[model samples]
Target: MSDRDEQAYAGTAEGKGPVRIDEELARHLENKREELFEEFEIRDEFPPEVLREAEERAADPEGDIRTELEDRRDLRELTTWTTDPADAQDFDDAVSIERTDTGYRLWVHIADVTHYVAPETAMWEEAMERGNTVYLPAYTVHMLPPILAETVCSLVPNEDRLAHTVEMHIDGETLSHESIDIYKSVVHSDARQTYNDCEDRLEDPDAPLHEANSLAYELAEKLHEQRKDDGSLVLNPKRDRAHTIIEECMLKANKAVTHTLQWDRGLEAMFRVHPQPTPQEWDEALQEIQELDGVSIPGDAWDDPRKAVNATLEEAPGRQLDKIQWAVMKVMPRAKYMADPFGGHHALNFEIYGHFTSPIRRLSDLVNHWIVYTDGVPDGIGDLCDHASDKQKDGETCERIYKDFLQEVGLDPHAVNNRGIEVVDDPADAEYTA
Candidate 1:
């Protein structure tokens, strides 16, 4: 650890506040990890039986993959592709868009993890216990074994994979919705495009994929405007056009799956719910913003906090915007998983919201897929909802701890006081009066 980091941990910084740092940073992180697992009741490792089953499946990949394909529409010929970080390990979702006479036909394909790991099986039990994968800066602890997480269930390029499809038709005018269909399907990704590559494609007029890239961005702009009109909170500032396009596609798919599950009243599943801020929470947030920049929040902000919060964020100075955003988020309650979709996502302004994408990493999405296929949720889903929420919090704790450790070791210079050290030229001559 650097001297600054040691001082920060040891509570020796000049007169800010008292903090207890009795142990080394790495040792503290180890203890914190153990505490988190204990507090959240997380199972850190897969069961022996699960490992055995996964090993068997990995040995004969072809035999099991053939049996897992059923009731799947063959979409391998479509112009389908995935967009993620360049170093992304597990590719869980992909998109395909085509122009229609009245609107656009968009298909969101998510990995069908349930096809291989059925309910009540050892692998399923392990996944349920883990709740979701915890990603640290240097590594990831997956919920499933490598057989499914990295190879079988991952939607790799040029490989045929099974998936659950959310097929919807978007109106060309308002970019509003139309009919929605959910089903199991098979697809072969045309390419594994990165966000950087997508941005390049958007700018290249002569590129072969220019049309599709432009169409996706255009739809994303409309969706963004629609959300702003509905008073959705804009916590994150507008990023790259490519990032927005991928986000909008995933948001649409999640919303569609949520609505379908709600329509099928017989199904019992968890929903990604976010409650409106209480009066006290809003007051605290306003007070924080006032202290930071002496900006007064409008009185009408009480009725629609999303608009008021977003407006203030826009007006914040660029130098202090990150701090302002962090303060505002700290005052709001965290979103959680619930058994019902009564309270939708306040940040997104959606009437129904659930996680249906990234099933390979999250267990809730896998459960939703099961509901879509079997029309039933597993028993004790409510308890599972609470467990999943706690596990997510624990995962965040793990990441924070690892990040601190990395900073201590100088692996992440940004996390420490990185101002360059002053160097004296001809130090000996200067001291001895050259």
Candidate 2:
């Protein structure tokens, strides 16, 4: 935390706001982060040139959007809105959906980051080097400069911003894609909603975007059931309705884009692949789960390890849930990025899958946008896949170490994540100080 961060939570209420710490413990936390960043080779600061370029691009956002307005689809009439965490800084994706005679018409609009950060731009190169956003409790290392991402690239309400939209007509009966279209568009979001707001809207008839939120969950719930039926492993089946809506929609869009690249267009792009566990490894995980004090898996679900884990997680005792999850994770293989989609993703049980909805924080999505726009493949794509996979691992590791250090200093990572951090002069005001 910096001097600005230290003062961000100066007068937070004792129990209602951030976790307060004294100056001495705050220094220790800062020192540990520096050591960890140095050890892991993580870049925390953006180059001056990249920041300058970002500033220049963001200077006249509306004027730039006007220039491209004639070339792109104008979708300002569509009822579009974004949902994110309450503390989110940038809104990357927005969704619009409606019922059709056959099924549903869904539109997922993602930020046109390629419009601002092209291959030759400094922001693009800096984003490539960082690979993805690194998020720690109460802190974040952004892939792109915050000013640019939170400004022009953000799909804020009532502003016409450039976007890469995925329009899909889904068959409600079979839960299959009827058609898919990818294109650039100018979108106007009606409102920005929080997760809690979505939940409230689900229950309130008069709330804003109520019908849209309800219809999204109606489709999302079906998608969720279909995914599980297709042998997809859902570790968090009990997630809240708001999260389910976002996750299912993103998955559907990513899958739709990946299928278009592989089956429809026959182009080589970044694909997400996951390998399955061996039979013996599955047996070992199941045996471990069954041996737990208050956990059991049904005989029918054992035929599919993914299904088996889901069943157990839904029924297992609360106290034994962590053990059950760890057992399954111990045997599961890590998913990685690849150009070839031959192996498939076992966890999602999808023939093809790739990221497309989060260009602001992910390099793969940013590159894929360029590939889709130009209809051309970049050189050394395999090398780029490897770099993305490795850098993602590094970010996850860095986060884990930072969280562990938080525990060492007697701070609850979850609390700090939710309420943020504050520094106080008085020791009595500190939540934890050692």
Candidate 3:
């Protein structure tokens, strides 16, 4: 017999294994091979630009874009004029302050992403491929090339960068603001600060930070508390399972964007909104809550929708709120791309809320900023949204396929067990045995 045939039969002849490979085993092996090939592709496909940028950053971390902007003395350095960028490399959004006849004027400057990531540039294509930056447990997969995302397109300080600015007139007492205008403009970030540091400085006068930073911190606090009092939801949703520390930066950035959109732009943009609970779903959620006794609903549930949701969630600690929210989300129509002149945000009970930040990370926000700022729309804003949605779906599928591949390779045991065929319903008893 041929050597290959001989080897194939050796195990069977020794009574150590099956005589032939089974279909299931063959399929599993094929999946494992495919997974290894994909891993190879990922490694090989690592963008050369990103690698170069990483090397440059490694060689001179301080020379990186974030650092340069933070050190600049232009508008970015003036706390009274503009707040620091959220992250050092963040070039997308900036907060501006002005003394108005009424009290104060605040403007949020957002990067005009459509200006650079036109229809199908290499950076735009890469961003589309990623759907969004994926913050895995150990690493991050950015949606755009680092050169653009971390530098040029970023809303860095000191440099006169282009932006879609949203100006607002604030009533200092209630921390409420009326949108004044949304238009393209130029900005220079004076500083770069993280939420923790900013919050600390705001709470403690002795904390070392720019003097103007204290004012920004105070304003942010007033706005935060005002939103809570104004019926804004404040459910601290559970994070993804494979948590990453970098996500905190992203969350803070998201909050910054939300604040800018709601307080400055005044235009209603698509939001990740959650409707009030329906009777049926609320009942089920309540049942689940009752099952776990000793949990109390928050006292202020009736006063705020967010508080109410928090109260329901307080009944069960940990992921109970997240799971319930997910269930609630499933019952509602998903928030999608749309144009609304009135600032109608049902969940927040606001007339205006949009996403104008994170152009470096999200395609939708990038596109939205362009539409609101520039006089004319980009080549294909509608098509871009459609394509972005498709790409997002495709990425999700690829993730699922990769997880299955890992299972086949014995790298993810939980995945394998989870995929086992589930019996939906039992057939009529016909000599059935447990």
Candidate 4:
């Protein structure tokens, strides 16, 4: 559920509940969501057993997490931090890095969700049923209950949390993996930084984690440059520094884990396979783009459609972005989850790719965590892939419908997405910025 191609349909995150709307509008919104949920067979409620299990695990996270500290790597001394959205609820991942003489030592510590929601647990069953978290502008239907994410699984600042860390020694000159290690560990996030905070720190020399943040961006920029140079299609090339940092880090870490699973272990797990557009499809898409007003496809980039679209996007008129994206989307096939890493990921130009981040939200990551932990493949992985793929498409469709409904009710989906929603008795009583 990488959904990097998401700009094709929608947006990103930060959570503060809901935007202020009157009761009538609120009722309408709720009804619409209900309709979408019913239509897509989305389960918004956890069974009683699942909720009780989550509650028990959440009741004493400190005690539970403390019990496992004996055998795990103690990384509390590391200057680790999480960078998420302004209103993020649970931080599932944190990063720490050091510049080595030969390369950079990067550590990506993810919430050890599998520790609490193991294969035989009620929570695991519920998560598998949900497939992935469904996010609709101001609301989110979580795969795992909020209790687990809020307590045991969240990498909250200043809290010692169990983690699955992916440690990589990346060669500075080659930007290639010199070495990679994945292990269980204990991590203490020093701070929870918003994307804006990351940007501010990058500019402030005296700020805490400034040097580390700068180093991260330096490495991130290198990774990004290398990715684009390798013929990766960046639908949105003008992404901010903060987004770039997370994107590159996660991509590299995911690549590292899947590469190990496929090449080293020869295991069948959840792998992402993105099909490339045919030459004719690419030509037609390019022709469509070229025909658009204030758009041009460079002569040199024609051979690589990915590069051509990327270049066009970087220079194309802002208003025509949706059109250009639509053209490409029409020609491209939907990326799907597979038991094997074959055909690769086309948009990313990655030979092997899979999910290992955001286990709280994505079933694929959760399943991969189990695979890596037990060296055991899930039964019927191919069927599971189809279920995940179908559920993902369902979530996307539901989100689109929800957003459309919001617009019809005189609300901005973007505003609601960024600011969240609040239900009030009367719309006039609610204070709003715009």
- Compute each candidate's TM-score over C-alphas: 0.83, 0.94, 0.58, 0.95
Question: How much RMSD separates candidate 2 from the native structure?
Answer: 4.6
Give the higher-lDDT candidate: 1 or 4: 4
The TM-score-based order of candidates, best leading, equals: 4, 2, 1, 3
As for TM-score, the candidate ahead, 1 or 4, is 4
Q: Lowest-lDDT window of 10 residues in candidate 2?
A: 1-10
Candidate 3, residues 1-434, lDDT tens digits: the string is 01010111111111122112234544554564456436533221447765564344335433443444553223333342222212233445666565666666666666656655655455555665555543211123457666556666666655656565556666667545454555555466655544444545556667655444544544555554465566654444332111111222223334444555545555344443323556665556545544454555565564444556655654566745656566445544433444432434545555544455567666667766654544345564456555555554544454556556545444432322222222222333211112
Error of 3 at 190 (Å): 3.6
Clashing pairs in 1: none
Candidate 2 local Cα displacement, residue 194, angstroms: 1.7
Residue 351 of candidate 3: its Cα lDDT? 51
The lowest-lDDT stretch of 10 consecutive residues in candidate 3 is 1-10
Off by over 4 Å in 3: 1-77, 80-91, 96-101, 120-130, 156-160, 203-206, 210-213, 237-277, 298-306, 311-334, 339-346, 378-383, 390-434
User: Which rank order by lDDT, best down to worst?
Assistant: 4, 2, 1, 3
The global C-alpha lDDT for each of the candidates, from Candidate 1 onward, is 0.73, 0.85, 0.47, 0.86
- Model 2, 1-434: lDDT tens per residue? 00011112222222357889999998998898888888877888889999999999889988988998989999989999997765566778999999999999999999999888988778888988889877788788888999867878999888999999999999989989999999999999998987778888999999899999999999999999888888888876567788788888989998899988888889989888888889999999999998988788988998888899888989988888778878888888877889888898888888778888888878888888988888888888899899999988998898889999999889988777767889999989887887
For candidate 4, give the lDDT of residue 224: 91
The clash tally of candidate 1 reads 0
Residue 18 lDDT, candidate 2, scale 0-100:
80
